[model samples]
Target chain A: MSLASAPPVRARAVLPGFRLTFGTTLLYLTVIVLIPIIALVIEGAGIGPARLWDIVSAPRTRAALRITITAAAVATVINAVYGLLMAWVLVRYRFPGRGLLDALMDIPFALPTAVAGLSLTALYSANGWFGAVLAPMGIQVVYTLGGIILAMSFTSIPFVVRAVQPVLEKLDPALEEAASSLGASGWTTFRRVIFPAIMPAWLGGVTTSFARSLGEFGAVVFIAGNLPFKTEIASLLAYIRLEEYDYEGAAAVALVLMVLALVLLFLSNLVQIRAARYGAVTA
Target chain B: MTRALLIGLAVVTTAIFVVVPLVYIFVQALGAGWSAYAANIMHPLTLHAIWMTTLVAVIVVPVTVAFGIGAAWLLSKFQFRGRGLLITLIELPFSISPIIAGICYLLLYGRQGWLGGFLARHDLDVLFALPGIVMVTMFVTTPFVVREVLPLMQAQGSDQEQAAVTLGASGWQLFRRVTLPNIRWALLYGAVLATARAVGEYGGVAIVSGSIRGKTNTLPLHVELLFNDLNAAGAFAAATVLTMIALVVLVAKTVLEHRR
Candidate 1:
């Protein structure tokens, strides 16, 4: 009976044809992704070790790195709290113009970096609208660290909100209701429950925003005035290096930026993995 | 109660910082009288910049979408050794600063680049050429469609594909009949996003583009050139057009999201 009546049942034993797909994927990525990155390393190799050392150790490169890291860190920290709140508002409230506010989160994503830079500079420049008010307070923005932070933060905000918004939407409302029902206050419930669930996403957003801010060039250049040893970013320095045809120097600095970006993305992936694992455990 | 306050603060901050500046650019651009606006908008360079930008988008959007579909199909449907690493690598461009992306292509195809001299000896000029600009823009915009489409493909199971296979569907038939229908919306969404980004891309393209007026200068670069030339009104006018496209993207994304 088993032989005569049994239906074809090798499906479980025979997995889908993943081998073909995987091979194609590998080839595609190798062509598009690995080769370019490897080419960078190879081109960088021609410069040799001592020159690489000099490139990374140069005062200007150091200054650029410092500016990049400082501005990125400050922008990330600012957005971490604010981004979460923005996500929370979009998810929790039904206020007037909510759709407009929600749509606004993506403005940074679509706006050209150069245009954003110019507009931000216009708004914050001494002769610009906001600058008029800021200047009277003796708080200069154009060509300063403050302006860089503002511009970077502007471009990087969506990374945080977009990352966190989905998590916020999926959060269980009944959990909050249950906590309140059980006599737990709103603050306590959030601290104990909501925060734990959203913290990982929030962290992911921060890391992404930080990485974006670190690599930002267009928006920062327009407003920062590209002053060396002051507002110049790692990216701008790399650009300047290219402008001067310092190819080796530019590659060296770019390699450093690439490594830093890789580290941040690695960390972000780690957090995402942990978040998924934790979600599974809790579920 | 405190949560409400927190939400309010977030909404307000995002609106003020992210939204206002975007809207303000266009408003300021249009602040001039209609006669001045007509004159500003009708400049030969303005038309040329728009045409160049559209040409770049027309070429870039299709090639990118194709690359994205192929890459996304492979990533979503396949499970193999180094799959995670490959996926991570595919996204590296998105994370790496665009400035670095420009440098990467320059290293590969610039005048003194690895293949640069090889191509040059063959009379091929990539850098400071339209081919160079499009290639760099393609690099920057590659991740957009794949990022959008791949996740949705993953979430929607492959049972329909299996069913088609059981029904004796060829690879093309299965993809066209089963996979394409499920992913069409996602594909369109991704294409739109990629187009918007490509149109607005400045950092990488600016590097490789050489910004020769009426030749390689894209709209965004043109705006920068105008601004630098201290023709603030002209820069603002061009920027306003870019902002209008951005607004359309915003509305499109919102509508698409709501439909989803």
Candidate 2:
């Protein structure tokens, strides 16, 4: 029982097979993920920073990055607001088909991105269902950044809903009651008492969806029409660069996507910690 | 009332964005009549696509499951240096664009790649081939099982297992009789999600698959190919298969979440 007694065999992890499993996990991760990423990074770096800058700073690459970031941001902002609305509706309201709506939130999580892309294109094309309605107003979605935003939003839909739903559902009803009793309208009660409570969670969800939409590919490609200097996106551009045997081009393009991913993940983690702190205070 | 108005907007948005796309796939799938749908399903290349997709899943799910369980057990049970970094690294794939993952494999294994000469000298192919697709798919879907199972294991604590060990339960016995049953649902959930992503993978597979039609095209890629070839009915028909899978996964997820 003494501290000098070989740490009492173990502090935790009473199970056996730790070493074997740990080694295998590391090996699998290295082969499957680490090596490939390192190769890509090395390839990108091998091009020299000067050449790398030249490739990435080209007008074509700049436009792709701008379009990708812009569309992803637009989609994320929409989903963030819409997601709060959707989560609130699902959590606060009781109506027929409620359970169905709740379960249906994960449709984007389950649906193939390519399928989503195809169907979205069909639904928004000039002769298609909603497209027919918007076309008369001289509004075009497909082959434009609007289509890109739509595809990104569609695939990233589940993140915001899933993230904020549980938090909203778990909010104390008494908070709303107190706010209302204090001469608050429904909107005011929400803004004052409810909004701050859910703000961190909402931000977390929005950042996550933003991150997802940023890297989105399959769905985006189909609807984007892949028009260079216009509808082209970074991920799609990376693919095209690889296809054209421009390995350096592809690596540079992918490196940007990778950097964006790391940044978004960092941001998501920050929001999560803040959200957790807020949650503790509210609770 | 604004209440009704707000809810109505949510409903309409969901209907258009979520419900319609789902409904559209099925309707277009069946648009070509029952016979056309059946023929598309029965088409040899379509069948091959299904087989290839299934093969990838079949290989990936179990390997990932094993890796997931092993990693989760090691990770959740014991504290070690660099644990946080290891976790972040495992989760790195989730946020990385899958297309980038594919480009990575292509860079390492493609004919012009660094290892290309060695692979070619060995007469081994890993790029624009089955092995390449498998590797990239594995990379992209890597975190699903671990992400699902790790938290479950962590929250479970080691109390029960510790008690079992003191009572003279062997490692194998403890795992089989205690640990396995506890995490079974989460494990299954992880497998299902991983399988879903694996089957539906398009970006990474699209890169390494070379879109070799009958040779390497998975179902998602095949759908893209069909659409590209102006075969709308065929594309929809193929997409219907994926939609059905999505529905099944949704049901499973809801059931699992309810249990939780």
Candidate 3:
């Protein structure tokens, strides 16, 4: 299979629909995805660097970005630890309701974000189920930073669990046995052997989770107070700008988010590539 | 003891984080009793939102499935220049936020957008209408079917396809007989995912839909409207419909995963 060369000239084409499929794919992608994204870039570029900096550097913009990043980081941390635990348990153990638990992991992906947001907000509001329990302790979740992180974590949890599960399942038991035979404790074996095996995939998942959390709007918006400088997230900020007809402002903020998401996604792809290489070596 | 402890922790965390909220949706939806819940679902605006959402899914699922098949076939069967870039571009919408996608469409089709003037002159109303909502939903859910199908096609390879071609099969016959059978489960799985996403898409649609009460509101949008209006019971009732769709998608996914 030639990677960069023209299609090989054959007396008979082995498979059909090359031209038709390729043309349709290209046309659909250009109209549906490429052109719209290009429009965003062009709009952002049309704003001169000086004004772009002004928009980004403005207090409200900076606050929103900071809150988004901070909450996402917090959420990613929660997912990283919790996801690893879930993946390890799901892959390595059997218990009653295990399949049900496994299927439930995807609720975040399957459930609409707006519904997730509403449900979460309800469950954490002062009079709500969990919120009622925490309110007396002065641990308010809704309309606070905690709610933002909770919403982010809830929406992005599957990324980590799903990412790490396959890697953990594929891990060779012999490596752990070897570590144990060498007098390593169970914890040591996990830290030295199992940890390294799943590290790449875990990192990839965590990065992707962070990226998803950063742009999470529907899930976070309902829970977040949306107070301009307090709990407002960057994506919501962009929407607010749009609502105010500040298209340039919206584009500038969105460009920042788009770049962040793309860079993280690129990083994730790189990590997955590395993980694939690592898997090849181990297998 | 250690095994039990670990298992217990995992189960509890999953319960709190995953299961509780799901149950909460239904509970809240029914908190006002079955009669009230039925009334909320039967509300004219809510009914219209459901219809609108279903209409969008009916249109989006088939179109996206076709695109997915075309793109998967092209990428998996043929190797060429910029294939990697093309694949990346195909998955671009996954990384970008849906709200940003809305903005992208708005920038292209809004009244003051790039083609906004052109569209206005032509009397084309794309933004704040069905077209705009459909476009953004398409953008957000485009990657699902392709992502699901491409890897399976690549792994299965074109050997069977080659055999069919040598058997004097026409393009349509080859795909319908060989490729379609091999990928039908995955294609359906992708379609299921796309439907879930299309039905539930909120942010991008929210940006473009203008939230016209009975005209443009999708179910998810309607839920938000109800929630913001402090009608928790009404919001959850509408959300219950979306939740049911999500549950169905989950079941489809599990079945497809087993078959695949």
Model 2 lDDT tens row, B134-165: 98999988888888777777778778888899
Pairs with steric clashes in candidate 1: none
Better of 1 and 2 by DockQ: 2
Model 2, span A1-283: residue lDDT tens: 0011111123354567778777998999999989999999999889999999998999999999999999999999989988988998898888888899888788998999999999999889987888999999999999999999999999999888878887887888888888899899988988888888877778878877988898999999889999998999999988888878899999999998899888977887777776665552343
Docking class of 1: medium
Q: After the best TM-score superposition of candidate 3, give how far the Cα of residue B64 lies from its true spot, in angstroms.
A: 0.9
Root-mean-square deviation (CA) per prediction: 5.3, 3.8, 2.5
Return the clash pairs for model 2, or none. Answer: none
Off by over 4 Å in 1: A1-32, A280-283, B1-8
- lDDT per residue as tens, model 1, A191-228: 98888888888888898899999998888888997788
Question: Going through the candidates in order, what fraction of the true interface contacts does each contain?
Answer: 0.57, 0.68, 0.72
Under CAPRI classification, how is model 3 graded? medium
Model 1 misses residue B139 by how many Å? 1.5
Q: Name the runs in model 3 displaced over 4 angstroms.
A: A1-12, A278-281
Q: What TM-score between 0 and 1 does chain B of candidate 1 receive?
A: 0.93
Please give, for residues B142-235, the per-residue lDDT of candidate 3 as tens digits. Answer: 8888888877787787788888888899999999999899999999999999999999999899899899999989999999999999999999
10 residues in a row with least lDDT, candidate 2 chain A? A1-10
Candidate lDDT values, in order: 0.81, 0.87, 0.90
Q: What is the TM-score of chain A in candidate 1?
A: 0.88
Give the candidates in order of TM-score, highest first: 3, 2, 1
